[model samples]
Target chain A: MEEKLVSLPEAIRAHVSDGDCVVLGACLEAAIPFAATYEIIRQGKRGLDVAAPISDTSSDLLIGAGCVGQVTGAWVGNVSSGLGHNYRRAVEHGEPHALKIRDHSNLSFGMALLAAAYGMPYAPVRTLLGSDILTSNPEFRLAENPFSNGGEKTVLVPPLAPDVTILCVQRADVFGNCHFWGSSGVAAEAALAATSVVLLADEVVPPEVIASDPSRVLVPGYRVSAVCHVPAACHPAPMTGRWQRDSAFFDDYHKRTRERGGFLAWLDEWVLGLEDHDAYRTKLGASLEDLRIKGEALSAPANYAAH
Target chain B: MADYSTQELMIVAAAREIRDGEVIFVGMRLPIAAFGVARLTHAPNAVGLFECGIARYEPSAETLYTMADPANQLGAAWATGLLPMMTQLPAGRVDAGFIGGAEIDRFGNINTSYIGDFKAPKVKLPGSGGAADIAASAKRLLAIMNHEKRRLVERVGYITSPGFLDGGDGREKAGLVRGGPAAVITDRAILRPLGDSRELHLTSVHPGHSVEEIREHTGWALKTAPRVDETPPPSPAELDALHRVDHEGHWR
Candidate 1:
């Protein structure tokens, strides 16, 4: 089989299909490989299901951009700050379906995916047993009331095997063996549970180097269908890379998003106007320089000492 | 005691209880504000830890940036970087924790996950981030939230943190309490655990809030302190400090 290396969008387009369930692993703003998500959005495929441990800017952006048809996760805060108007409109107006899992239940989503990856019928979860979550959601039910006279009070969550898992990491090899120094377990589990995996990395290093660090290797190349080398891909946001967050852009976006009209206008200027992350950075122009200074100031020693 | 505005009051009251130089884990949103206020004012040496791994962060006087911000690493007097800080939190090194909730039962069980249903929820919220570990491991737990019937329920829809477990010697049975939720601060009043029942009782009501106001919102029985004292209002200086830390006024 010929191995493929391409940009994030190409890698995603090569694998993603309509009605495919997807899992993503990223922090609030740093996780989702925007390049891939943008491709998914541009494709405008429906019947897509997404499961993330936590939803951040990328997840919200995808939903807002009309890419995700169904979402299951813990919370949607910090994704464009408290569920963007698009997500709210979709869920409230019944345009798209959304299933909001409770915190306890949210943990189970990850556990269940882990179980599925391991080929289990269902994962035994301790979350949301006594609460109304069990009684309310038919998807979750009491396997046996462990509280009952020596019985097991196991809450059974069905397996969640996504069709594709998309993750962005700090570094990877040409063969797709990846390494993330920070929290990689969440994304790793999502990748294992999914049918296929696509990795977008900040840099493409030699496979031998990744192999040498047995402990740091998060995802093996065998599981990955494709690898895309995209530096500073998580733009207008922070990523674990050489580049820092474009704070000025974020502040502007934050301010504009609070106002409904201004948000739509800002989205147009940023999301619609930009062809890619590079374009977005270009449009900001002087503001990006200002942000660099602010970023440095915010990260400076004097500031730390003052606090 | 400082004269605190609503925002400053929340921070000061919460901060006063936190000792200096303690490792306090903080959840996102309001708790972040309270932690910032506490760090900038009372507990200067106290470390502010986020679930995402920022530790002992010295945030700018203005703006509590995202927990993941690299700026979170700027103020660390020590060499512990973001990755190390993230590791320590789950390993249970944090001393105190500040959390907010959508609902809190008598047992101190908190729910910030969902409202309405689970499989299909009316509203989805940010799930617990290191809440379970913080609740389980922290020597002290302090909760700050607005008192409302919907929030101060008899039973939470979900138990994100094990609050007094099954009650009585139950926490001991479940092995959940090294130290657990010591106090709960709300807009209306403050509450503490009563006896071994794990139930919370009112210790004091803020000025202008009556006992009935507290009781009306409480799903469980509301107990009164031996001598209830009004919480001091935030002074202008404290308010300015708080606003300076959180310029967006989202903390308010």
Candidate 2:
């Protein structure tokens, strides 16, 4: 079996080429690829299109670092932390770089990814008929559903296959069998739709442990290009079972990032200055201890002796 | 006597609007609290679904800032994937939903996307996170928002979520099979659509608020209901539940 483990920088460098369209996992902190996101920023990847059903801090920080030129997402807010400063600056003032925004509703965006995963030409969206999204994006078209009640109206959105997708999960075995629970937003679908995937996990367990509970694995190892053992991968966004969201951090971030100078100062100290995840952890210091929490095991390990 | 803050009253009013046993798809921020209040009170059986895949969730005593907060996801019966979870709304299983926005019009069109022009916005708010989907597909859409003319407007600059869509069968014409803005729940009063006209009319003013006050804040030439009633004050039980769900008053 190929060892899928690699450094976060190596994973990003290998799979994510410049100008690639990347969709970060944004199930509101469930599995945010923040470490990978920071690496992408540190590498100074540019002209990338950032997409999410809800682009929270992950997308906002990417925008802040001038790594993305376009955004294909529904919403880009800090969520519980007020508006995204970089997103606002990009949209309102066009600072850092001019942003090209392709609007999508939460369902339409997620469904498009699902369509791609299902290998469908386009997904029939039941909503957005009356919203400005149909008017704004020509790609989103209205087609009458021939099967439903003689020409029932529905919006047909084209499939979205991102160049790359990165997700942070609670655990993954050496071969990239990823396990995530709780509020899993389009992670599985996005994983399938992406041409390349980088899996960031809190820990990489032995392959036997992963095989023991096959049911717990959401993304199969074959689908993943690289797996990086990244603890606290979803920092500002909490990983389920591992940690609760640091509400105070979000509040502080909101205060810091509201202004451009403050935001840049933050970026310099936290993101740009850190060479790797270890450095980032060292900076986190004692707070990392506070973030740790234990939870009950989710699944039973099946015995191979019976088989 | 009800010991209620304006936020508490707002949450209670919004909660009371949700019918019992309705499948309520709740958006984050204020709507989460309203849905929590509903579940604690009259709408216990109502399904509290989030776009992030939490289903049949009961808000914990701990105040969570976002609907996607892990705390909010704790007691969920099943953490279904996004497709299955989000598809529930458009498949038309959703009876009601709670939504919020920056600006709204008389026809109930909402603008949470941008403040000014699309290309060059004056302010960029988070775009739709299942709000438009809920608005388009829910059998009845209850918008929970604060009362202010700037928010409740005559015409929104951008329409992120379509309500009745310029009124009078606009939603029907647009092929939204079910659901329109059933009511706008605000701190001041509850505004219901006027029959088929689709124009919002002041139905009930919250305790200590007036029809004139709701009218003063509404964007259009607001009309009063045939027999507008004073909204019942939040009961102690309701206030207690609200406080428990929103322990920190983050949204409160």
Candidate 3:
């Protein structure tokens, strides 16, 4: 039978099952596929694990909405600006999920996932050995130094292997061949390590174009199970260039989330009211343009010469 | 009196303290400029160790962007082999550490963790990234913060890093007596250890700032030097070095 190519949701639903570990490539309130993540959360799926470098709205939202059972990474922020109640409730109150490790151990996490994908017994990492992060997280244990010559040296780390990986990209082909201009190595590593890969992209370009420029082909067709070309799907929030996160909307969301009664009411308007990114953008009106301006402003300046 | 902008003043203050050949650990944003300024002026041999593992950074005329910026690595010499740069600080190799804080309490306990409440925070910031380690381990910790009422608070919302739990005795308890924060330089004034209390005493005020102004903004009882000296203005050379690295021209 030939392999299938479907939308992001379908691919996720097909691959992801109960008690399956998942890895996602996301950063701080930037570059995440909210549409797919929202669907995963909506299903109330249990045992859905995640290994991400940094957490933002998508990770927090999933954890908040009871989609994630276990998360192994660092940091979390809410869809509503600044509010961390949802995250606290999910982690502290909801399930009391295990924290795999603390501190941003990206290289360690990457190595572990790679080890799993390659069917290795263990992966060595130089991070978290001397720090308290190793001592704090029980899942990670110290191993005797393989290179010890008469000195006491040990390696400490936990193995990480995700069943599936989901990511959104600026451009891709029909097949799951995707391209990311910014910060490609970590994301690519995560995808390559996962058992299955699903990609969501802004637009589907010709395969020939991707093939001609092989360097641009971040992920090959063979690795990806599905490729969904959803323009502005990662909306209401920004997608680097297509759209930017509405700060005023976020401010209002933040205000509402401060109070319990106000939070539920705001959630009803923002989360429940919108069907998808299209609907969310409609409610946002022309403010999306302002968000674009804000995004440009944030990324453009490296340092403030005067204060 | 020195006529320098806030950023320039900070660079000048930070530059004066660094030695000729010292390993200075710098965080993103303002610290980069301070280190660059130091390099350009007083301490030309001063090696800048970025958190992103870039060591001995020598930026071009226009050095904007974060330390993790790919442009920072361009034509840069990597000391990865000699130092194992990433794990050096935790390994106790760094000499001096510089950090910025959102809020600092009377005891110098910083709170970049939570702005209001942890449960439903008003501002969820980038939590302590080696700040505690740097604070605890570095031979000398130099803090650079913009002077504001909100920042110099009586109590921090969250203790991102324990500065001085109680006072001088606190460091002994935390096992960081040998190396810890020595001086805190803000836009308004410079604070150093007062007496046996370990309480930060205002040693000097910036040219335009007054003793009353520092007292008014502080959340705790402000301490002062018996005789306050006006901070010397940034030299023309210092100003040139500072503006050289500011790619955005915001400092210009």
Candidate 4:
């Protein structure tokens, strides 16, 4: 009963339901779950309310493939590669599909997710006190801090308990104990906050291997509902200790998806066109191998002889 | 005479502005590049706090790998989550941080969200990442951007980062005290808060740029510092380090 093994498509099909407020655990470039995101697109999931504190690949691709209906994000740029062409076209021009946006500073958005993790009604953040993000969004209200020396206006952000939070982790066990290195961004907060978790891991080690070094364990097995083994889960985005961010891939993606027709074409060949992540990786082949490397792990892994 | 791109001049100027042994909260791209150069050249002990939550990170300006990623981020003092580092900004722990926007006004408030209106037409920019938090929390906020008339406007379409709010006592009224935008280092000139107000006044002009041109580019009635200093060209040492860091010509 403790063992939770599922395919990427099975995980998406099992966990991600229609109209779910799906949260993605990502940063500018680290631990971005691009493979899981493509599955959501291939499964033809629709009307998804996508959420991320700061997005680059995960949210952009979902929105591009017409899987997302609304995008609640902080910053939506394709770092180093410039603006996200799909994101720009959606919000600015509403080309392939019209997108609804609720903006927050990356901090405030994390604050909201943190509130849900703590099981609190709202989280009080100080950084958004003077920014227009508070002014523009009516949901973010300035409440008088009762503890404030009388005049301080603190913005009370509501909790964001997403129905699902899909994350890319460095390693996980069959029992779903996930470990991550480098920057977790808001993933730690979002994972605890979400109602369900779909974990996409680069390498699935034995439970003993995950237990060997407990310090690396971020998400406990109990919190994770499904653990799918997906190698190179963070394509384009860098996996800590394993590979560097594929800046060239981002450059090519930006150039290819500049126009609506071209973007749809990319979706055809990459996401919808491919049967699954393995197929997608097969197409990438040698170039994908070039990006692979051995990350600095805490201990010698269980060596399950993964595919 | 040396050939340096306008970006290099600003990077050197920004690095020079950063004092030794200070915690600088830097964002992606240009700010990170400037901090990297600063670490290699002058501020060796200077800690670079990234939005991704690496505290006191020292990046190799030459490799210029993505600082947000820890694998690429070398010589960081501590590897922590965003929670503690993010809270540090509001606690007034950081000495200075870098910020930029589509538009910045005399009051110093910036807009990086929308160009025309909030809910309407025109360009919709990628909203606040950590710039708003950095601006609100840093003890001394350094605003760096390319100098253009459209960018330097009378009033930003929206205030994504609070500079001084309205002017004098505006930031204080909003419960912001310790850190607000102190200076703007751009390609054309260096601007500082005027007198008691947060209004930007040209403190110095770059080697090639003229004060008149700077004023003409500014959206408001730009004032000049009593003794405007001509920004010296980037030293050979600084230029050499900068070029090595930004070998790809991203911010060269």
Candidate 5:
């Protein structure tokens, strides 16, 4: 097998390209791969079509930085502070450029991604029926359910196969066997559906450890194109067992990105000026240490006694 | 009875909607806090199904910032991704769903997409997050929002979630299989779809608030229940449970 391990910059440089349909594998939840996202912005990737089933500051930052040409998602916002200021500006005002949006419900979009993962043409769903979501996106088709007797119908959601998916997980091996534990949100499906995957690990462990608990592997090593060892990869967003959601930082982000000038300054100070996650951590100082997981509520070990 | 804000009363009212042993697809904001209150108080056996695919049999140790918050996964019955729980909606596994919106019409059609034109929006609200899916298929839908003219409008600019749609079997005609807009729980009153027209009517008003005030705030010609019932104030026990659920007073 080929060595998949690479630095964060190398991973973004090699796998992610300009005009690529990128899936930021976080669904308004923990383990948002912001380190990789910052690198994508720093590298000046352009015309990128970003897909986040349920987004947050990650998508907004990309849009604000002028990297994103379009966004396909259910929701995009700061979650805590308020709406994504950059997103609102981009869509309503079109300050940077006109952003093409393909709105989808979390379930509908997830089903589309699931269909892609399963190598299916499309997934049929019963939802999105009397809503304008059907009218907004021409790709979604309402088809008669041939299986049902009472003239029932199903909405066929097109498969979403992105060029590359960036997944930030709790741990991964050099071989890119990713292990994640938390409230999950289509990370596994996104990885499988993408043509290639870039795995970002906060703590890169030995292959032996991943093999010991194979059930924990969300995405297998073979599907991964590159693995980047970047601790605090999901900073500001909790990485489950490692850290907590930095709501104060998010609040600052929300405030700073209210205007274009403040937003660019935020990008410069946070992404451009900072060399890497380490420098960003240094700038954050001791406060980052305080956000570490305080108490233990460990899951019971699953016994696998096979000789 | 303890002195509680209308927000607290609303939360309690929303909590009371949850049956003791039903699967609910809980949306963000007030619904999350309401579920917490429900689990901690009356509906201990209720199961909360988040859009992110978390089946929470018990309330989180702390209040949730988002439905997909890590706190939600703690002690969860099951933690999968969107597909599993979302699949439950069509399979008839969900009993009721809680949805919120920026604008909602008398027919209960919700708009969270945009405020103005579809192509060029004056304000582009956060697009439908699982509200549409839940609204379409959940056996019963409960809409929780503030009682304001802009919110309770004559017609929403966009239908992000299907309610009665145009009313009078419109949802069924559009291929929606399940129930639509069971009730609308606002800060001032509880509205339910009445008659075959399915237009929302004022069923019960919270104490200290009159039918006139509710009608004044409503964007449409609000119909009143012949005998309007005053919503019961939050019990001391309910308030205590709510405080513990939202210790930080984030939602309150």
Candidate 6:
């Protein structure tokens, strides 16, 4: 097997191209690929299209950094703080330059990714009938159900295959078999739909460890282009069984990034100024220890004894 | 009856709409809080289906700031990708769903997309996450929002979720197979669509609120039910349940 392990910077540099449509794994607060997102911002990649089905904050940060020009998603905002300041500014005032938005509900967008993974042209859904989302986005169309009566209508969403997908998982092998628990979100479909996969793992386990429980592997090695072992990759965001969400950081981020100046200062302090994720980790320091998962609810071990 | 805050009243009212053993498609913020109350009190067997593809039998082990919070996944009954969980909505498996919007019309048509126009907006609110799907397909939909003239509008700027599109048989004509908005639970009062008109009318008022007060806050000339009962104040047990669910008071 080809050696897929690489440094975070090299993996990002080689796999991610300028203006590539990128999809980040996980929905809202679980296993967000923030390490890779910060790197992309530091690299100053522009005109990129970000797929944010239910953006937690990375999309907002990327937009704040002027890296993203287009966004396709249902929502982008801070869960606790309400609006995404940068995202709101970009759309309402064009502060970070105008952003093109193609709105979709969570199901429609996820189904689009699923369709792409299946190599289908479009996915038919039952939502978005009377909503303005159908009329506004040209990509979503209404059609009569072929097998049903002419009156039966459904919405057809075209496939959306991202150029690259970035995921942060609990563990993976050097050959890139990712194992993660908690809400999967649309990670599997997004990974399968993307042309290239950049996998970020908290631990790079041996191939034997991955083979121990085959069912836990959400994404196979054949689909992954690069595997970078980046501990604490999803800082601020929670990685189930690993750490808890740093609510203070998110609250502080919301407070600090409410305006253009605050956002820029925040971008400089957090992303551009830092050398790498290592420096970022160092800055995090004891807070990492504080946020570490304390309680345990271990799943019963499954038997895999072969005759 | 014990004194209760409007937030507490809203949570209990929303929870009351959910029957025992119902499968609820839970949304973010207040809906999650209400679901927790329902699970702990009236609806013990109620299963919450999150948009992140989690079927939770119990409330989060910890406080949840978001729908996809890691705590929500701790004791999930089933966990999978978003597609499967969301597919259950259109597949007619969901009994009821919860949604909140920036603006909602008398018909319960919600707008969470933009405040002004489709092409341009005065303010860009968070777009429909899974609300459109839930509103369109859930057996019955429950809407929760703050009671204000600006929020309870005559017509929304954009239809992010379908309710009774233009009232009478509107949802059916729109090709929606499931029941539309059954009730709108707010901090002040409960509103439900009435008669063949399907226009939302004041069904009940919370403890100190009156019909005139609700009308003053509503953008449209809201109709009143034949006998508008005062919404019961939250019981001690309900308040306790809510506090336990929202330990941090994030939603409260």
TM-score of chain A of each: 0.81, 0.95, 0.79, 0.93, 0.97, 0.98
Q: lDDT per model, in order?
A: 0.63, 0.83, 0.61, 0.81, 0.87, 0.87
Q: What is the TM-score of each candidate against the true structure?
A: 0.73, 0.96, 0.65, 0.94, 0.97, 0.97
- Computed on C-alpha atoms, the DockQ of candidate 6 is 0.79
**Rank ordering of all candidates by lDDT, starting from the highest:** 6, 5, 2, 4, 1, 3
Q: How accurate is candidate 1 locally (lDDT)?
A: 0.63
Question: How is the predicted docking of candidate 3 categorized under the CAPRI scheme?
Answer: incorrect
Please write out the lDDT profile of model 3 over residues A182-203, one tens digit for every residue.
3332456567677787777877
Q: Report residue A158 deviation for candidate 6 (angstroms).
A: 0.3
Q: What is the TM-score of chain B in candidate 1?
A: 0.83
lDDT of 6 by residue, B101-197 (tens): 8999999999998988767778988788889889989999899989999999998879999989999999888888877999999988999999998
Which fraction of the native contacts appears in each prediction?
0.11, 0.83, 0.01, 0.61, 0.77, 0.79
TM-score of 3: 0.65
3 or 5, which is superior by TM-score? 5
Clash totals in order: 12, 0, 5, 1, 0, 0
Deviation from native of the Cα of residue A136 in model 2, angstroms: 1.6
**What is candidate 5's lDDT per residue for A174-289, written digit by digit as tens?**
88887888767888889889999998888889888888888888899999999999888888887677887788899999998888999999999999999988899899888889
Residues B3-119, candidate 2: write the lDDT tens digits: 677777777887887788878887766667888888888888777888888886576556666666667667777786777887888888988888888888888888889888887
Give candidate 2's TM-score: 0.96
Model 2: per-residue Cα lDDT over A1-307, one tens digit each: 7889999999999988788989786564567788888999999999998878874688888888999988897888788777898889988888887898889988899888989988999998887888987876778988888888778897998999999989888889878887777787888888899998889988888887677777778789999999999888888677777877777777787789888999999899889988987898889888876877666645444566675
Tens-place lDDT per residue, model 4, B138-196, is 89989987789989998887988889888888888887767877789988999998878
Chain B TM-score in each of the candidates: 0.83, 0.92, 0.89, 0.92, 0.95, 0.95
How would the docking of model 6 be graded? medium
Q: Between the candidate structures 1 and 2, which one is better when assessed by lDDT?
A: 2
Complex DockQ, candidate 4: 0.64
**Model 5: docking quality category:** medium
**Candidate 5 Cα deviation (angstroms), residue A149:** 2.3
